[model samples]
Target: MSHGPTPSDVAAVYLQQGPYAQGHDPHGHGHAEARGHGAGGPAPKRVIVGYGFWIFLLSDIVMFSGFFAAYAVLAHATAGGPTGRELFDLKRVGIETACLLASSFTCGLGYVAALQRKQLQTQFWMFVTGLLGLVFVILEVLEFYEMIVKGAGPGRSAFLSAFFALVGCHGLHVTIGGLWLATMMAQIWVKGFKPQIMRRLLCFNLFWHALDIIWVALFTIVYLLGAGA
Candidate 1:
């Protein structure tokens, strides 16, 4: 005699008729949802923001890489002008490095305070980060000024040209970062840890920390190595 529909048959019918059917693939073995398609909602704001910012950062790194390669190729083409050993001041560079590194720490603290919903602490830490970043930019400007006064400007030689291009690009980024830091602090003071502000703060933190990392490389390769050369 014919048997009634079994549990497996019932389950198969439900799969086809239920909500799962919305995302089900007719030809594929597994559901479309399993492949992160069909009816799945958009990713969280944090993930989407973070992923997009990372893509931007990677593109920025590629640009920096081009500057670095140019500097490496032209480091020795001084054309009788001052070399990095002659122009670079280790003590000043060391101080700039210290300021940037310290700013990175404060940026981290600010992010943590934001996460904890401590508005005052977040503002305070971000203020400190901005101050440190401003100091870095000032020191960089002074260094550039001194070099130009000594007739070692970018126009003097290929070596100086590359030097100014690479280091100046980094300094410009730091300056922009300082402005960003100030804007973030103002937003935190006014908005008080809103989700969108927090996402912007997170992006700022990533940006500030990335600058510190790039500065470390700049300090080591451009300053340290160049000073020794």
Candidate 2:
């Protein structure tokens, strides 16, 4: 008579076909640990940092959305004051747009240099980016000053109030981004592309790029449309 399989045979079969056979640890770890601890443990530092920064960016977009909606609603509420068609200067605004868009390109180049670990190249591009950003901010401030001198200040009418609230918020973001870019440049100079520093540079790249996207919307809606109106 044929006997049943022995205990040793059973154990051998289990070892060949069980969870351990698929690289599961007997101590309860899974194959994910071998693949960089992505399942049971924390994600990679780069992933975690990037995800967090994206969340912050989304929240910022939401805030800007609120301002845009307010501007749209009050866009025609000039209350017989100077309307956008009268106050807007498309020429200056066009120059500002060019500077900001150019800064975004330089910012991308800096990020690529950072990835390649070229310190001098990264610094050079970032310096150019910051310079362009500074020019944009100066132009915006001068625009505001000119508007105010012409008595089209925010307090003059509901339309002007909404205009300043929307455009000023974006200008403030650009100023903050410029400050952030300076900080990142200083850190790269001192730290020399450490993991944490690279992560920060990536965040700065995203932040700068997002600002460019926002400025495009602002330029089309506020400057172009306003001047045409």
TM-score of each: 0.85, 0.85
lDDT of 1 at 75: 88
Clashing pairs in 2: none
lDDT of 2 by residue, 108-198 (tens): 9999999999999999999999999999999999999999999889999998999999999999999999999899999999989999998
Cα-based RMSD of the predictions, in order? Answer: 5.0, 5.4
lDDT of all predictions: 0.87, 0.88
Instruction: Report, for all candidates in order, the number of backbone clashes.
Output: 0, 0
Model 1 over residues 87-196: C-alpha lDDT tens digits? 88999999999999999999999899999999889888988988998999999999999999999999999999998999999999999888888888888888888999
Superposed Cα deviation of residue 107, candidate 1 (Å): 0.3
TM-score of 2: 0.85
Q: Which stretches of candidate 2 lie over 4 Å from their true place?
A: 1-23, 27-42
Which window of 10 residues has the lowest lDDT sum in candidate 1? 29-38
